[model samples]
Target chain A: MNDDDILEQAARWRSEGKGVALATVVSTWGSSPRPAGSHLAVDQDGAMIGSVSGGCIEGAVVLEAQEAIKSGNPRLLEFGVSDEDAWAVGLACGGRVQVYVEPIE
Target chain B: MKGALLDRLLAERAAKRPAALVTSLNGGGQSLVTAEETHGDLALPLNVVAAARTALRSDRSGIVEADHSRFFIRVYNPPLRIAVVGAVHIAQALAPMAALAGYEVTVIDPRQAFATESRFPGVRLVTEWPDEALGALRPDRRTAVVTLTHDPKLDDPALEVALRSDAFYIGALGSTRTQAKRLHRLQELGFNQEQLGRIHGPIGLKLGGRAPAEIAIAILAEATQVLHQGEAAEAEAAGAL
Candidate 1:
């Protein structure tokens, strides 16, 4: 799906009473997979509509998104080559990215 | 983000008005910024608002450091568009190619037989006369216009309307002699030298190919070049500060 469709889908899910969280790639450094505005929408049930990373860190982002949905608090997540979570989460492409996750009410 | 704020942002985007959603990385703050107004509950400082306007002008989204926190400026600009004032073979090849390159393509021609759906599937087909079609199209700064009919009757009318608009790129297909003749006619129409110079006659880069598809590639390459000509200036302006 394109960028617009992902946001529309998030709104649709929210209207359906499903908990939704939006994760946007706020910044990137080195050879990041996605640009700064790329989005990934995740629901409480672990369902996702788009991707912030090509495939490198969606799993980690989804986990963070679910947590944000539950806590009702936004989060600024940073993943880089030097972080162990980056390696564990498999952002093995030697790039760094900052994602902002916020719950949709 | 509140649903109401998201709706407003989407509405602004639907109306093709540029907007930015500024989110504080430290959380607990967000604001929606537009050309003449600001929305959302966040009480943004003047520097953040100025940064948002600069981001809108540059058409780039990223993090801005201000207010002792980081704000992510996510921009929403209208999609770029192209209006090809002919349904000829070059347009047939160009329409889909332009679409794939992320431009909304419209093929305009009054000839019913030439502008049929089968000839240009999935592309907007305007059967109205060239001038009327373009007048309605209202070529904006994000738009590109190309005249490929090679007939002055059809091409000239579209060229006249397109030249008057803020279209980022305007090109017409012809030889050097044909371009001189076309320029002469436009000059007679009260267009000044600089206005007439906006028409990139001979339409495309000199790829030295006569095939329709090859010519389309040349045209698209040239248009792409014209489209991105502002980036360097923007970067330079940013650097100067």
Candidate 2:
């Protein structure tokens, strides 16, 4: 779904009493998979919708989003191909992106 | 992101009102900026709010750094819209193609036979007179209005409304001679030269294509060009001001 539809879905999940977090690609550089403003919605059960990147970094983002939901604290996550975690969760493409994850309180 | 703020943002978007969500990375403090107001946990500085307005105008989302903090401004502008004022064969090709390109396509034609559901499956069909239809549609900066009817009664009224509005792109299908004649008529109707110039007559990029679908592609290409270039021009104008 597009980010707007995902936002609507996030609202639905929020109304349903599912603790939800919103992760948005706030900025990108080089061959980033998605543009800034791309969104990924994560719920308490780890269910997710939309995407902040290609399938590569979603698992890591979901973990952070779940943490934000639990702690009621937001996180600014930066990932790039040059990072030590590149092999595990960084974008496979040679690009960098900053994601902001916050609970949908 | 309070639930009430989220709802207000959604409501503003639903109403096609331009807005932005600004968040400071350091504190996670956020604010919503609209044309008239700003509200949220943070009271952003004037420069940051100005940056958000610029982002809204250009329809770009990005990072804005000010006052030793990093802020992300996520702009929420209305979806690009195309109001094709004729359900002719070209529009039969243009409507779905524009939709695929992420435009909200509306085919306006009063002729029921030409504007039937079968002709425009999965596209919005407005079987009202061109002028009335466009009047209600209220074309905005993100809207592109194209008159393909090639009839003065229909195209003229639509052109009048379009030329009076801030529609980013206004195209009318015709040859050079026809365009000249159309311009004369609009000029007689009180539109100044600059306003008349906004109409991209002989519509579409001169791709030298003749088929309906090929012509549609040319029109879409020209419209897309105007959409982006117009945004740049507007930004330059705002900067000048």
True contacts kept of each: 0.71, 0.68
Q: In model 1, what lDDT does residue B48 have? A: 85
Regions of model 1 farther than 4 Å from truth? B175-177, B188-193, B205-218, B238-241
TM-score (chain B) for candidate 1 is 0.91
Q: Give residue B65's error in model 2 in angstroms.
A: 2.5
- What is the iRMS for every candidate structure? 1.5, 1.4
For candidate 1, write residues A10-96 as lDDT tens digits. 888998999999999999999999988889999999899888887989999999999999999988899989999899998889999
Show model 2 residue runs off by greater than 4 Å. A54-56, B184-193, B206-211, B236-241
Question: Residue-wise lDDT of candidate 2 within B115-189, one digit each (tens)?
Answer: 999988888999889999999999998899999998999999999999889899999999999999999999999
Q: What is the lDDT of residue B45 in candidate 2?
A: 90
Residue A56 local lDDT, model 1: 88
Against the native complex, each candidate's DockQ, computed on alpha carbons, is 0.64, 0.63
Cα lDDT of model 1 by residue, B105-201, tens digit: 9999999989999988888999999999999989998899999999999999999999999998999999999999999999999999999989998
Interface RMSD of 2: 1.4
